[model samples]
Target: MLLLGMAWTLPNTLLGLLLGVAGLARGARTRWQPGELALVFHRYPWGPGGAMTLGNVILNTGASLEVPCRTYACRAGLGTEPPVLLADHEYAHVLQYLVLGPLFLPLYLLCGGIGVRNRFERAADRYAATGRGWWPWPAPRLP
Candidate 1:
C-alpha cells in the first residue's frame, strides 16, 4: 500500500517540488500547518486566482483559482484568505494526485478539455465537496 501510494504520487511530488521552487523564486510564499499539508501562495498579482504550474499542479495567483496539487494546494481570492469552497476544491485535487500519480496529469489532460466534466475532475469535485474537504489555504499564488 505504501509503495502504491508512492508510485501514484511520486510524479506530482517531484513536479510539485520543482514548481514550488519556481513559485518561491517568483515570490510565492509557503504556509505549513500541523497535521495538514502546506500550501504555496502566489503573489504576482495576475489571473483570476487559478493557474496550472508545470502542467501538473494548480497555482493560485490572485482571484479565486481553485486547482489541486499533491500534498499542498494554492487557492485564489483577495483580502487575507481564500474562500473555503475554492480551497476545498483544490484540496480535492490533491487527493486525486495521491491516487492517480503521473497518471493524474494524463488523465486530467485527456479528459479535462475545457472543463467538460471528465472522470478525473468529477472524482476531484466529489472529494472536494465531501464533509472532510477544504483544508486551510493561503491568499494566492505567483502573479
Candidate 2:
C-alpha cells in the first residue's frame, strides 16, 4: 500500500485531497465522525442533483478518485436500516484503494456497467457481512 501510494503520488494526492475536501464539505453539511476512517452522517448534500442522494452510500467520481474518496452515507431521515453497514462497506472500498491504489477507479469503471460493479461491491459487502467491523453483526441485505 505504501509503495502504491507513492507510485501514484500526484494522482493519489489530488484524489485524496478531493476526498478530504468532500469529507469536510459533507461534515459541514451533516455530522462527521472519525473512525477506521472518516464518516459523514445524517445527510449528504453536494452532487449532480444539488445534493441528490440515491442510496445510503454516495460515491465520488473522476480521475481524482484514483484513491479512496469521501463517501456520503445517511444516518437520519433516510430510513430505518442501520448506516453502519454502509460505513463498513465503504471502508472496504478504502481498503481496496489501498491495495489497488491508482488502479482502483479505472478497474472499477470498466466493471461498473455490470451490477453497479459487482466485483468491488461484493468484496465490500462480504466484508461488511462478516461483522468484523466496528459495528454490529449481519450487514443489511442489499440487492
Candidate 3:
C-alpha cells in the first residue's frame, strides 16, 4: 500500500513542480526593469471551498499609474498566488501574454513585462466596465 501510494504521489508532485517552474520561466523571460513598475503579491486565506479557495493580488506601478488586481483558486490554498518562486511582475506578464493576443508582444518586448502587465490591467478595467466581475472565486464576504 505504501509503495503504491508513493508511486502515485511522486509523479503528481513532480508534475506540479514542473508546471510551476514552467510558469516561472515564462515570467522571467518577460521581466521588467526596476523603476519601470512594481508587482505586488497578496495572499488571502479566507477563500472559497473546493478547488479554488485562495487568492492573490497583482499590482503594477510606474511614474503615473498603478494597477491592482486579484486572482484566485480554491484547492491550491494561498500558495497558488502566482507561485512564490515567480516574481509577481513576471507572473502577471505571463498571464497577460496568455490572455491577451500578440498585440501585447511589442509591449512585453519594448517596455518589458511591466508594460504587458499594464495593458492587461487596462483590459481588466475595461472588462469591469461591462459590470461583470471576472474573479472566479466565491464572494469573499457574504451578506
Candidate topping TM-score = 1
With candidate 3 superimposed using the best TM-score fit, by how many Å does residue 52's alpha carbon deviate from the native? Answer: 15
Query: Which candidate order results from sorting by TM-score in descending order?
Result: 1, 2, 3
TM-scores, all models, native as reference: 0.57, 0.47, 0.21
Worst 10-residue lDDT window for candidate 3 reads 49-58
Clash number by candidate, in order: 12, 0, 7
Show the lowest summed lDDT stretch of 10 residues, model 1: 70-79
RMSD of each: 11.2, 10.7, 17.1
lDDT of 1 at 24: 70
Reference-based lDDT, each prediction: 0.49, 0.42, 0.30
Error in Å for residue 39 of model 1? 4.2
Q: Model 2's lDDT to the true fold?
A: 0.42
Q: In model 2, which regions exceed 4 Å deviation?
A: 1-10, 19-34, 38-43, 48-84, 113-117, 131-143
> Can you list the residue pairs that collide in candidate 2?
none
Clashing pairs in 3: 51-74, 51-75, 52-73, 52-74, 52-75, 53-73, 53-74
Across 5-77, the per-residue lDDT of candidate 3 in tens digits comes to 3343343334433443344433312223333222222221222311110011122222212333333221224
Off by over 4 Å in 3: 1-106, 109-112, 115-117, 129-143
